[model samples]
Target: MNFIDLFAGASGMSEGFINAGFVPVSHIEMDKYACDSIRTRAVYHYLKENDKEDYYNDYLKGNISREELYEHAPKQILDSVLNIEINDKSIKSIFEKIDKRLGDKEIDLIIGGPPCQAYSILGRHQENIENDPRNKLYIQYGRFLKKYQPRAFVFENVPGLLSAQKGQHFKNLKTYFRKMGYEVYHDKLNSADYGVLQARKRIIIVGWRKDNDHGFPAIEKIKRKFTVNDCFQDLPKLKPGEALKVTPYSLNKNEYLEKYELRNGVDFVTQHIARPHNERDLNIYKTAIKKWNRERVRIKYPDLPSHLKTHKNESSFIDRFKVVDGKGVSHTVVAHIAKDGHHYIHPDIKQCRSISVREAARLQSFPDNFFFEGPRTAAFKQIGNAVPPLMASAIANKMREYLCQI
Candidate 1:
């Protein structure tokens, strides 16, 4: 049950596996901010597990800073994040500590995805398709497979990975793993199908050692569909530029909300701060909402109120400002939100602002108790880049069930 997480951005995949009863010996990430978030999570895990109730109480009362809590975290967990490339000599430290942390157990699982921009189909054209250096990071993953030889591994990336090079890249990827003695099952999995409200389509590759017979888990259609409303409806409404640092979540138990509840039983949520919008964008949001309500459906660009049709690039950015209908599955939450959230305008016209970091996190299926540590934009980047914890939980559950039998 011991695992190593690579390319562990904010430890989203690690969170899911750990929640499913797997133990992580180390989480390797390169970004300092992301590593801090993962380390903070480890601190929370330590506090919760070691029965340090008073420390948490002190934290809430502002008697001790978050830095003080880190002092109490186990060194093994604090060292969990190595902010360096996998090939760097720094990786030696993780190998040095693995035996001490895991004892007699071999590494059972390896989970993560490489940086995906070069493999994304949308960002490529004829000249740059094969020239992206990030495309070579798969070799780093393969290196881990050869060294650790885990019982199973999970690799995630954008769906475009399938078509990266006229299908040759995918074929070669499978062939390489097969040579490593793994039976691989690779496919595009939509997060919405696995209970995440966001319609994120990621390529998930699950591999088992040749001797194991576990096929990928069955995909079942959900009876009760989750939507933008289901995820964000309960949050307090906000106007442009308004922000609330902390607010209480209304306790409501539904299958969806249960997965997103605060695990520590904390009543308040942090990072609910909203971003300010210029007058031009606010007017556009107002028009988008007013027009959509009137039409009771999607509002085309040409039909937008004339005053809002000032942009010259109508055809290219036609529906640039989108208001997600609360009743429908949310549009994919992408890292572009870090630059500007115009692509994901709040569904509520009264708010008249872009989606906040916390709202984006909700759409991404991060648990209410989990905190992203950084600037607001950094938080958005972390959430946008993460795997939805609930969706990841489903995958880990199936993987664990099979691993136990083996």
Candidate 2:
């Protein structure tokens, strides 16, 4: 199958589709860096090669930055980035020429969510969706979908799209899709239920051509629950601050610490990961855990597990680390919240560090092989913003099975 990706932040959906055997034809992205990352490949090859200083000097010594080498990049890299359909006409011209390389292949799937700040819960209260400049991105996506007329489409966003303004915005979106002659099926999915160790919930809407009589196929249930330990237990252990030579494991550590130790620039997650926690947060964790432990002892009911009670007790330490029940689901793995360690943290460790990038990616069910790029901030954002790969894989598998029968 052929596809186009828009608002392709790190190509999460694209990777999922590709793993499911679909070929991505084009992608549109506003962030040059993120575009650069996705443009490279499903993983960071440059980083892997860069570590081998000898290889860089022998083969890439005078070559332009990887971002500038797209014209000469291999077919695989070009498909991921060069065929970009952009907001700028000048850029679009460059992409048209690249499209010629595809010859007569037909595009089959159009997948992506637009710039989603407007649909984010934080953006709604601080910025009005109606007036928010970013809200119109959906219109842009709609225009792209109409022009491409791909047989199938997938739109994803924060759950805020459902309850934002009591559902008025969602209502309008539904009507708009109906007007386009597409059968749209949307629902909020918990990533944990689909194999992600975290409990991220997102609104995923799949639209199919009315003639197909088939929309998104059902996703298989996760075979078993995952936990923080299951995802990160194999990695080398570190006290709050550490780094490793493995590219992915290396990127997972706080960049700032890596920068400070290695003398390079770092991004938000790296800095947060590298930096030690302040006294206030440390104290809060201690207090919270103490209060929670006391409450757990006082409770007599067996229905409520002591592990789940961590959510109810706000004393402080409980927020840092809570036992993740093997039989239950996990909390959403948000980015850069390591400072607070509230979202996902080590259940056994008492340290200030939040789960590392590798840990978070694992919780998101990203394959250990899928590498990331940019500073710590970019890495964290990409991981946090992505559709859990395992979830997408399951969905894609089901869709493939159903389509074969058709």
Candidate 3:
């Protein structure tokens, strides 16, 4: 299967798509940091594909940073992303490049969602949400859809798209696609259905050129409740303010931990270090955990102890500083984690700090080998914004079987 990725973040849907045997024809992204992160993954795959993975092997052993890994990158991956800026002037040039790389090859699919901030319900609470420039990004997706005329396409976004502008936004989207003459099917899917340890819900809209029996993939719900311990127990523990660029991990007896272990070299635990926290925040975390342990209750915001109740707008922050119950799946990891990480408090009573970048990625079902490229905070943002590769993979697997038969 061949496809194109638009609004492609560092990980999530595209990672699973690639793992499911789809070849990425092009990746379009606006953020430079996110582009860097995607490029790092491209380089890693290039090295591994060409039997030159020793370069990345060295980096895994603490011999190089992510930047240095590219110095030894294969020409194929670099050229794949060479010139395709997303601008009015560059759209034509990008189309021409696609023609060159994908010459005479019908694009089997086009995949991606418009930026979701403008359509997110929580984000709409802001005054500027109505006319946010990003609200119009869906038109850009339309342009590509019309140009490629792929046999199939998958569009994904937050459920807010269903209710934006009193449902007008969603109505307009359906109208636009209907005019294109494709049969569209949309549904809200939970990540937990695919074994991701986070309760993230997103709307997936799949379209087919001609109607028959095919529709969106059927994803089965996971019976096991993937908990905090299942996702984070094996990684090295860290103290507040402690940071390490590289550290060894035990070849633990867990599925994920075992997949990431390095037998000959020191496979570093990347972006797993803790950030510094103020005394007030630290004390609040300690108190929250203690309250949960003694009362078997979650310490949500607005119910904070007197010393911790500082915000005047307490009602809006009711779920703020929330400590995830250790017995079940984590709450949805949002991009807000990059700002301060207060929402995703560690469930452990002793580790009075926020979950690290690696932990957040785990909740999103990102594989341990998938290294994120950026500052620590940027890494967290990318993880929070991803679609959970495991979930995406299940969808891709079903789509693959159906499309190949066609």
Candidate 4:
């Protein structure tokens, strides 16, 4: 089966569908860094397919530059990632690019959701959010469906989308997609139910052509027996303001890592680096860690000592300085993590810092070999915005089964 990814965003959904044996016709994304990341991932997949993963490993080892890695992969694979925004002015050009990559192969599915920030709960708190341009990006998504007429589509977004604009937006979206000749069904899915250590929840909207009798794909729920600590145990520890591009694993792979294939038999891991924190923030992190370790209670921002309190309004976002629960599934990782790490403090007090890029990616169920292409902040934004590949793979597998039957 083949698919086209829209608003691809680091190719997280693309990663899962590809892993489930679906071929990507094209990936449409606007962010340069994320497009680069997707291109790098494409290189990895191509190299792996041809038994040239040593080139990929060398890139991770910093022995090969990105340009050199791209040199080893086919130009067509790299060119398939279109770094263009989807809008009225650009949609026609975007369609031309996808049509070129697609050739005569029909798109089996169209996968992606518009940026969810506009429909997120926190975004709704903003003034005049109804006017936010992102709220209408779904119209762009519908355009793809109309143009390609794919057999099915998977639209993923935050649960708040169901209630955005007093449910009118969602109603309008369904009406638009239905008018495009798709039978749409949506449900709320949790990542933890799909083998992810993070308890992230998303609204999954699946649509198929009206002629197809098959309904929504039955994505099976997986019962995970491990905790977030299982995801962290094999990683090398880091302190404030430390980064290791290539480092040996500190411990042997445990069952969880091995079971999920998080550690892909790589001798070294990249981007296991921590952000530098000032003493004041470090103190707050220490306090938060101690509280969670001792009493399993998260420390609110207002609970901090007067000397450490920086923000004046303590009424809202009180639990701003939260710690990742090492013993259980983590809270939803959000793109706001790029702005600051206060909400994603590492559980181990020894680190006394926010979770590193690799750690955040691990929480999002990205494998160790999936190298993110950008600085730490940009990588965090991509990871936070992505759908966990584990959950996506499950959906992809079910979708594939449904598509095959038809």
Please provide, for model 3 over 194-308, each residue's C-alpha lDDT reduced to its tens digit, 9 standing for 90 to 100: 7777788999998877753387767676676446676787677777777755666644546534442312233556667677899988988887778766786766776777787
Model 4 has an lDDT value of 0.92
Which window of 10 residues has the lowest lDDT sum in candidate 4? 211-220
Report per-prediction Cα RMSD to one decimal.
2.5, 8.7, 2.6, 0.9
Clashing pairs in 2: 254-270, 255-270, 256-270, 285-317, 288-315, 288-316, 288-317, 289-317, 289-318
Give the per-residue Cα lDDT of candidate 1 at 97.
59
Which candidate has the highest TM-score of all?
4
Clashing pairs in 4: none
Q: Give one digit per residue, the lDDT tens place, for model 4 in 1-406.
A: 8999999999989999999999988999999999999999999999999999999999989888999999998899999999999999999999988888877878889999899998887998899999999989999999999999999999999988999878999999999999999999999999999889998999999999988847777788887799999999989989988998789999999999998899987977889978899999999999999999899998987788999988799899898888999999999999999889999999999889999999999999999999888888999999999999999999999998888888
Model 3 clash tally, residue pairs: 0
- Candidate 1 lDDT, tens digit per residue, 125-188? 5476687767767777877788788999999999888888888888988889888888999878
Model 1 stretches with alpha carbons more than 4 Å out? 53-63, 87-104, 125-127, 219-221, 250-255, 259-264, 296-311
Per-residue error for 232 in candidate 3, Å, reads 0.4
Clashing pairs in 1: none
The TM-score measured for candidate 2 stands at 0.73
Poorly placed runs, candidate 3 (over 4 Å): 65-68, 82-89, 211-213, 255-268, 294-296
Instruction: Tell me the TM-score of model 4.
Output: 0.98
